[model samples]
Target: MKVADFHYERPDSLAKALVLLSRDDADVQALAGGQSLMPMMNFRLAQPDTLVDLNALEELRGIREAANHIEIGAMTRYAMLEASDLVRKHIPLFSIALPHIAHSAIRNRGTIGGSAALADPAAEMPALLIALNATITAVSTSGERKIAAKDFFLGLYETALDEGELIKSISVPKALIENRFGFYELTRRHGDYAMAGVAIAAQHMAPLTGLRIVFFGVSDRPLDVTAIAETLEGQSATDTDIVEAACRAIGNQSLHGDLNADAATKTHLAQVVLRRALRGMNA
Candidate 1:
């Protein structure tokens, strides 16, 4: 199937874009880096009445360190994030996950906003943002609002964005001196979507002060294991003991699997990736 016929408009400014989007008569979709959107359109999975191109909105591009957080514009590409010194310095977790997001071509064209808005459960950005305790800035004709990453993802291909509202930027707290991070993903190939992946952040070791572990590709959305992670604190368990406890934490998560693996297989792989992530922590 081919993309259905749709009217296209390229607004010169964000205001014009917002005004174009506010038209209730048409089913409007914003086009950024079109990595996923274009494919969906090609597959007839997405058929909008109008396409509003946002590429010219320079307001939504770049990475900068601000006060205690790093603000990354929504249109910023994965390659741009990988190349930015500010991103590496303030949010190294972003760096760690960049290499796993498809290939260099996709990275060069895929925008952060597009990834987050797509909200693909197997994608890395949503889970990484939640793991880092990031906040997303959404803009609309009414005004701008901030939504915590944890609250932004509703389910598969769903988000907290209201009608006509689009993600403008994301803010992640700068990594503190004591913060430690862990990231691991299992895939059939280097750039394939994860079979089971995890992104974790902890305050410190020795006693293990704090932990936030978000799992992806094993569920419909990025799964936050905060309650499960809290169990790690103040425990004097060996690596094997820790791994077992974490697996047990899986309990009844209602995991989903594709043609390559069943739910039970995904559960096992999730455990393997989670173990590797926790055991391979670096600040």
Candidate 2:
């Protein structure tokens, strides 16, 4: 079915977009690449009265390197991130996960902010951000607020974004530039959403300490298993401790059943992916 009739507005500036969103009658939806939104609209799942297209607002579309972090514009496309030297050099986990987002055509049009706002539990970007401890900045009439990845996602298909707020920028820490990273997922096919997955970014030390293991497609939001890091510290990831800790870490999470897999199946796959990720990072 076609989407219900709607009005489209392309604002020249973000301030204008905010003004448009502030009106109660407007029901404006921010349009970035329209990869996810368009399909929903076509299926009659989403019918916004006004679509506030942000593409013409050039200010929200590039990448910058700060002294301590890499600031990526929210509107930057997945394809751009896949080929970005800065992203490869700094946020390697992000680069690793980019290929898992739908397909080339979708990646070419899907923006980072769009994916984050969509908050699909199986999507790679959200899990990668949580694994890297990234922070997102939101702009609205109430002023700007910085939200950590852990607090950014609220639940399935939901986030902390308030009305009239647009994700302006995301700041990713530069400290993990040289970190050893591994991303693994079990999808029915390539480009399909993960049935269960893991993104691991760990600091390679003499004894191999400072690890961050994050799980997706297994919970309400991205699950960061920092306790797994502590358990793996000062020990070889090849050891049995890593495997046991990985299992225990995931066992604590209350996974939900879905069309892709049941909760029990996901819990098993989560263990397998976790072990695979830890080995990949160590190897």
Candidate 1 yields a Cα-based lDDT of: 0.88
Candidate 1's residue-wise lDDT over 1-283, tens digit each? 7788999999988889999988888799999899999999999999999999999989899888889999989999999999999988889898889999999999999999999999999999999999999999999999999999999999999999999998999999999988888899999999999999999887765566677788999889998876665677866545565566667767657888888888999889988998798788832
lDDT of 2 by residue, 1-283 (tens): 7778899999999899888877776678998899889889999898999998988887888989999899988899889888889888888778777888899999998999888888988788898888788899999977899999888988888999998888998889875534778889989999988888998777764466777778898887887777876866877556356667877877887887698789999898988887777677667
After superposing candidate 2 on the true structure, give the runs of residues whose Cα lies further than 4 Å from its correct spot.
175-178, 234-239
Q: For each candidate in the order shown, give its overall lDDT on alpha carbons.
A: 0.88, 0.84
Pick by lDDT: which candidate is best?
1
Give candidate 1's error at residue 89 in angstroms.
Answer: 1.0
Q: Per-residue error at 23 for model 1, in Å?
A: 1.8
